[model samples]
Target: MPAIRPQTLNDVFQQAANQARQKLPELTHNQQVARLYRKSLKVLSSWAIDRDIFNDEATKIRARFDQARGCKPEKAIRLLREAEDEIFAYTHPDPYCNPVMPGGSKFMRNPPLPMDVCFPDGNYPADAPKYEINPDWSKATPENGKAATGYVLVDFGKKNME
Candidate 1:
């Protein structure tokens, strides 16, 4: 697995949830949007369920792994429910920490610039009037090579775009 720690994941999830929550109120309340919001809540609840909170799964699995393992019913499901309740703490906040809920993109006519797109080098040229990923996009990769960090700049010059 990656270097994901509980603290880091919580921070990331909290930030994303905050952003999503911020976006939700801006959306027009309607049946469809409401349904989507409910669905996202369901997803959030599922993520809240954890094996670590309650060791039932581990206990059962461990027993099974044993050569003379004892067969027993899993009480882990109860632990999972408790985990869900705890996770709901962050989710219940006005600025949510979960993406499952409705948010900015879902509500906006013109979506806000995503925070993830902001990079250290810069997205817009200094001379450019507007924010863009690259000043010249059609050519090969920028002479600086490219960021192996997954995202590459998409330079959109101000006057060039409609």
Candidate 2:
């Protein structure tokens, strides 16, 4: 019978190194163009607040993309670079984001606590003070009576050092 050997630190590190070196599939020209167009439109949307103006600008963008298609490799690369530069130049300082989305203002505003942290081992002490989301939700524990902004800090009290 063959004995199963436990993995060493070197073996774990080698596996991780190989994974890190693995090549991602190269994007074809069409795929690259499509991604750039999508990115450009997103940037344009951030700047153009009015729907009609956005539509007109979007049409112009689509036309430009269509014109660039079927060109020689060098020209296609040049156009792609130009489009990227234009997008970067027009990138908004404060892009409009959906309130619930990751970059939005309301994201994680009233986030729920993880069950593991709330009640470890599926058990909670009955006499312990009830955990509730603070209305003010502040990191600053001010000595003064004024409320602070942001999520509340939780303290589970101290454990015996023994």
lDDT of 2 by residue, 48-162 (tens): 9899999999999999888877899999899888888888899888776655444456745878765569788968677754555433333443432336555444331211111
CA displacement after TM-score superposition, residue 121 of candidate 1 (Å): 45
In candidate 1, what are the lDDT values of residues 15-64, reduced to their tens digit?
Answer: 98888884445433234334443544444444446746325544543443
Which candidate tops TM-score? 2
Clashing pairs in 1: 17-96, 17-97, 17-98, 18-96, 23-104, 133-154, 133-155, 134-154, 134-155
For each candidate, how many residue pairs have backbone atoms clashing (under 3 Å)? 9, 1
TM-score, cand. 2 = 0.54
- Candidate 1 lowest-lDDT run of ten: 153-162
Model 1 has an lDDT value of: 0.42
Error of 1 at 86 (Å): 0.9
> What are the per-model C-alpha RMSD values against the true structure?
21.7, 14.9
Q: What is the C-alpha lDDT of each candidate?
A: 0.42, 0.72
Which number leads on lDDT?
A: 2
Among all windows of 10 consecutive residues in model 2, the one with the lowest summed lDDT is: 153-162
